[model samples]
Target: MIPETLLIEYNATLKTFDKDEIIFSEGEFARNYYQVKHGIIKMNNFNDDAKEFIQGIFYKRQSFGEPPLFIDVKYPANATAIEKSTIYILPKEKFYKLLQNNKEVHFKITESLAKRLYYKAIIASEISSQEPSHRILRFFDYLKNDVFKQEGKFTLKINYTRQQISDILGLRVETVIRTIKQLEKQGEVKIENRKVYR
Candidate 1:
């Protein structure tokens, strides 16, 4: 993550967006570097059947859609605010200059992307042939242990809803609900007040 001091150095502007607002649509020219200050942002695309598939979910202090600024291409997916959110936006050129001038920040960004890539790789492998339960647990574990960097016995409080989970895993919502219930029965998860914990 770029520190607040560093964002100021790059003249990044903090912008607020309403829930369900489109940050940018797929195929649009990428022009800014966005970092979430609060709330959830998701990059997604709809398939031929009109089903929505999530590319990635970005949370507070996280950044998204950086590849286009680096490679000079149109966005490959749409980004939207899942809730009323605050985001810091830096002009693409300024962001490039900022990265060029700040080796540490650049390294951090690279490291962050690398971790996300690793998670994607794991998910890709799981989705290829694994059962629903295996896929779900593997995905949940990665998000909890690697992406979130949580430690100890069990401390992950599932944030996304069951439908969201199903979309991410390429499964039906009914399947996700059933699988989660089975997981809870098997002591693989804990559901309290409709929130999942592990």
Candidate 2:
């Protein structure tokens, strides 16, 4: 992510969003680069029947909705604030200029985007062919290993809610609840005081 000073130097603006506020809609032309300054943001889409599919969740210092800015395309999903959040917004033209002037930052952004692409591919396969339990465990593993860079058998607390897991994994909330309970019974996960740990 671009540093706050650099973002400000490039005329980026910091804006606040209330929970559930739509930052941008699907199919809108990409005009800005957004990096979270505080709280959470989720990119998502709804099917015809109004079932929501979350594409990705981003946290502080993480950037989202960049691929469209790199390529000339409309946004494929809607970005919404999951909590009252502050975000740094740099205009697309200034974003391009900043990247051109800062090679190291540009490489980091490219690496981040590549990782996201890999995650999407893996999730697509899991959603298509894996069982609910397998999908859920893989997701937990992904967070621990890939995102958090944790190693070995160390216990890692899962921060996502059951409903959020269901949304991310394309499962019903009931299914997620049942699977977590099953995982606990099978000694695959620990449920302590209603919190899940793996």
Clashes of each: 0, 0
Superposed model 1: Cα runs more than 4 Å off: none
Give all candidates' CA lDDT scores: 0.90, 0.93
lDDT of 2 at 9: 95
Kindly list the per-residue Cα lDDT of model 2 for residues 1-198, writing each as its tens digit. 789999999999999999999999999999999999999999999999998889988889999999999888999999999999999999999999999999999999999988988899999999999999999999999888877777665378887889889999999999999999999999888998888988
**Whole-model lDDT for model 1 versus the true structure?**
0.90
What 10-residue stretch in candidate 2 is worst by lDDT? 146-155
* Per-model RMSD to reference: 1.0, 1.4
Compute each candidate's TM-score over C-alphas: 0.97, 0.94
Candidate whose lDDT is highest: 2
- Model 2 CA lDDT for position 168: 94
Pairs clashing in candidate 2? none
Q: Which lDDT tens digits does candidate 1 get at residues 23-124?
A: 999999999999999999999999999999998899988999998888899999999999999999999989989989989999999998898788778878
Q: CA shift at 46, candidate 2, in angstroms?
A: 0.6
